[model samples]
Structures are given as C-alpha cells and as structure tokens.
Target: MSDERRLDVLRAIVQDYVSTSEPVGSKALLERHHLGVSAATVRNDMAALEDEGLIAAPHTSAGRIPTDAGYRLFVDKLSQIKPLTRAERSAIETFLSQSVDLDDVVTRTVRLLSSLTGQVAVMQYPSLNAATVRHVELVSLAADRLMLVVILSTGQVEQRILELGSPTHLDDEAAVAQLRSRVNELSVGRRRAEAAVALVAAVAELEAPPGDAQGQSRAAVLRAVAGVLAEQREDRVVLAGTANLARSSNDFPLTLSPVLQALEEHVVLLRLLASMDGESRESVAVRIGAENPISDLASTSVVTASYTAGGVAGLGVLGPTRMNYPSTMAAVRAVARYVTEILNQ
Candidate 1:
C-alpha cells in the first residue's frame, strides 16, 4: 500500500476503535469504508503499522488497537478539531450569562464543560495576582460595624465585614460617601497588592480632631480590610464530571481507582492543567498517555487551554486515551473563548 493509503487506514482504525471501544480488523475497514483495497493488501499495511509500533494486536487471532504513539500521531497529523454547533454556542452563552457573582460563574462553567465533553472538566479560578483594583466599596451598618467590598478588573468581587475598636467615622450617608471617594482615589487602577498597601497608608494618616475615637476606628477598619484583600490572592481549582470516569471504567486495563484518586487531589490537577503553559490562550494543548506528569494519568489524555487574556487561569478536560480528540479539543477551545468574553464583560 502507498503511504497515503496506510495513513488513511490508520485513521480509520483509530476512529472505529474510539467509537466502538473494540479492536478493528483489516476486513472491517474494507467492509465499512471504501478503501479501494483488497483484504490481503490492508493486512499488509496493518503489519507495517505494527512494525512501526503505531498499532498493536491484543490477541493472536483478533483485530488491532491503536497504541499511545498511534493516538499521538493521529491527533497531531490527521485530525481537525470539529467546530461547535450553533445550538451548543447558544447554550453556553445562556447558561453563563445568568451568573450573579464570580462563584456562580465558575460553578456553572465547570458543570457546562463536563456536559459538553462527556469527560471530567477542570477550571482554575481566576488568579487575583493578575487582577488590579477597580474600586473599594465601604458601608457602615452601625456604630462599630463596617462592610467592605473590593472589585477587581477581572470582574471578581470579594467582600468582608469588620468590627471596629470604636464607632466609625461616618454614621451618616454624606460622610460615608466622602470616605468611599477617598478610598477609590487611593486604590482604583492599582494592582491589587499595591492598592492594598496604598489604602492602608492613606487611611493611617487620617487627621482627627482632638479625642476623635470615630476617626481611629475608621482607620483601623480600613487597614484590616486592605490586609485581607492583599492576602486573598489565592489560586483555587474546580472540577466536575468525575462520575463520568465510572461510566467508562472498563476502558482502563487494570482499574480506574488510581485515576479517580488523582482527580480528587486538587493540587495535582492544578499543576497538571498548568503544565501546558507558554502557548497563547487561544490554542489547545493535548497530552496523551505517558506524556502526563502523574503516572496515574498515564492511561488518560488531558486537553487544556487558558480561559482569559494573559492566561490568568486555565480550563480543560480529562478522558481515556481512546477519547474523541477532534470533538474534545473543539469543546475546550470554544468553552475557553466564551469564558474570556464573559469575564471581559
């Protein structure tokens, strides 16, 4: 068989194996596809592929299966990512647009991704380290009670309430409005860490008339809130569709136990997803079989892409090596693109 025909045969084998979860035979290829070749010629090509370690025979008399190397070649050389349908796009937009807060948006996104790919979905929470302060909202509920909310450029919102050492500087709306203006002036447009430091310094220097306990209380509350926001630059990860692993448990040669345990380790997954760095957020990275760092994931494939600009965070999915790469890659790319747009809004 010619080189073109052999590659075509290889592609056909991978497709059939993924769809049916069974070994594919040369006769099956000819019977199912118009390869324009006799059974004997196809068997010869299969032998050549086996010699190259791309395909393997699991039984002495049965058909062939694609090896990890075979899957890699198929993904890199033969496949084009299938584009999302219009209905899929509309569903994503509708589900994400209804989010009322940052937490809600992330929860919905992870769940939506799982449903789309039919595999385990993972997302890294937006990194506060990449965020800049947009504004600081301060409210005095009572004499000693203060509520503080910090808004970030990435549309993430964090809030905290404080009990001051004494009465607040403002019990009236006019005075509270003035404090908000001053806080924004000190913090808005600055990096989150830098803004926190500046806000604390500005509040500390507040001048108070003699014996002004309320001014002291205000300074203390602002300082506490600033410190909290600065320390809140935590990076967390969210995962969904873990139960999907159980559905295809038979795919794993030994058992899915190790893979399940690895998925439960949030830190391990964060590092695994971040392993595909240095590429633009628009591109998808696929790691097959032993290509993954954790050996437990050796039986799996990971497809990843950064969600927002500058790759502030990442999102991806995990499935057996027999996964449908074209469709999975398309789903990941589309989800990441939509997530970026939503956060930007």
Candidate 2:
C-alpha cells in the first residue's frame, strides 16, 4: 500500500474513533471519507497499518483504533492547528479582559479553557521571581506591629505582619515613613532575589546596639519584608473543570478516582507543566496516553503551551487521549497568547 493512502486511512480511523468512541472499520471509512479507493484496497491498507502497529483491533471487533504511535504520527503530521473562530476569540478576550487581578486572570483562564475544550484546565501562577518589585508599603498597625506589603510587576501582592519585641521608633509616624522610603529605595524595581539581598544588607547595616529597641524593630521589619519576597518564589497551579472529567466517565474505563487524585496532588501537574518549558511559548505540546510520566494518566492526554516568554509558567487541558487535538491545541494556544498579553500589559 502507498504510504500516503495508508496515512489517509490512519487519519480517518483516528477521526472516526475519537468522535464516535467506537472502532472504525473499512466500510465506515469508505462511507464517511472520500478515499477514491476500492474496498479491497482500503482493507489492504488497514491490514498494512495494523501490521505497522499504528492501528489495532480491540477484542473481537473487526474495526480498528489508532494506537499511541498512530496518534503521535497524526499530531506530528498536522499541517496547521485549527484556528479559533471569531466567536471563540471574542469570548476569550471578553472574558479575560474583565479580570481585576492576577488571581482573577488565572481563575478566569481556567474556566475559559475548560469551557472551550470540555476538559480539565490547569494554569500556573506567573512566576513572581521574574517580576520586579513595583512598590513596597509599610503600615504601622500599633507601637510594636507593622504590615509589610510587597507589590510585584505581575500584579501579585505579598504582605507580612511583623510584631516587634517591644515598642520602638516605628510607633512614630515620621520614623515609619523614613523606614518605608529606605525600604523602597533599596528594593523597588529589582527582582525578588535582588530585592531580598538588598533588604537583608540594609538590615545588616543597622548599627543598633544589643539593647537598642528602636534599631532592632527597624531591622526586624526589613528582614520580614525580605522573607515575604523570598516566600513567593514557589510556583502554584490552579485547576478547573474536574467535573468535566466525571461527565466523561466512560473515557476512563477503570475509574476517575486515580485521575482526580492525581489532579489534587498539584506536584504531579506542576512537574508536567514544567516539563514543557523547553517548547517555545508559541508552540503547543501534546503528551498522549502512555507518554505521560504519571502512570495514572496513562489513559489521558495533556495539551499545554507556555504563557510567558521565559516559559516559566503554562496553561493546558487534560482529557482522554481520544480528544479533538486540532481544536484543543488551538484553544490552548489562543488562551496562552491572551494570558501572555495580559501579563505583558
């Protein structure tokens, strides 16, 4: 059989099985697709494909289903990712543009992706480590208490409250203002690591005597602000549409328990998201069936794209391997681009 004809047959089988959740047979392929070939020729092509392990017969059924290798070939051979319709583009913009903060953007993105792809959507919070310190505020709550607010360029806010050992100069309004000004001077416009180092050095420069309460309080506030900057370096993920998985329970023949458990364990999802960092932000990465590292996800597929230029964060959808790759890839890519645009703004 000609390789082109055989590939066309494989493509037909994959499309048919994915849509109908049923094995594809030679007769159905001829009826559904225009192959311009005889039934006998089509049968021969199917046999060849089966021999190549690209298609397989499940149980006693005469029909064939594409194997993981076949799906991989189909994905790799795709000429173009299907473009989102005007309505899809408008919906994405309308929904995401209304976001009020970083949390809202991530939350709305998860919902939008889930609604678009009919699969579980996962997104990583943009890496604050890459975000420059936009501003810092110190609010004096009491004679011995203060609130440190660290704002990042990514629109994320980190706040920590400090309780000094005793009443100190922070209790005076002018003293608090001076310290806030100094903190911003040292940390503003720098990345988290640089800001932390600067804040720590500022604290070390304090010449407070061992028994000096005011100097000690100022150093404590600076150290606490540095700690807040350091703490946000860890990555986090948000998930939505887990109910979509249960709705497609038939897709997971065994049970949805394992899949649900894996999703709850954010580490598994984070590792999967991180693994796609090598791909460019403009490219979509698809891991099908057994290609996933987690055994529990062996029956599933993950479609992901980096939403940041540095590829430090990403968003994706998870569904059965029988998913519609073209549309899903398009949605993931579209949403990722929109997210990147928002982050850039």
Off by over 4 Å in 2: 128-131, 170-175, 208-217, 232-234, 280-282, 309-311
**Cα lDDT over the full model 2:** 0.87
lDDT of 1 by residue, 12-89 (tens): 999999999889998889988899888899999999999999999878865999999999889888456778999988
* Predicted candidate 2 versus true structure: per-residue lDDT over 1-345, tens digit per residue: 787888899899999998998999999999999999999999999999989889998868779888888899999989999899999899899899999988999999999999999999999987777878888999998877888788888778778787765675677789899999999999888888889899899887875898887788888888877877876567789999999987788877699888888999998888888887666355999998999889988889999998762236889999988888999999999999998888668
Could you give me the TM-score of model 2 versus the true structure?
0.91
Go through the candidates in order and give the clash count of each. Answer: 0, 0
lDDT, each prediction:
0.84, 0.87
Per-residue lDDT of 88 in model 2 = 83
For candidate 1, report its TM-score.
0.92
**Candidate 2 lDDT score at position 325:** 92
* Ten-residue region with minimum lDDT total, candidate 1: 273-282
Question: Which candidate number would show the highest TM-score if scored against the true structure?
Answer: 1
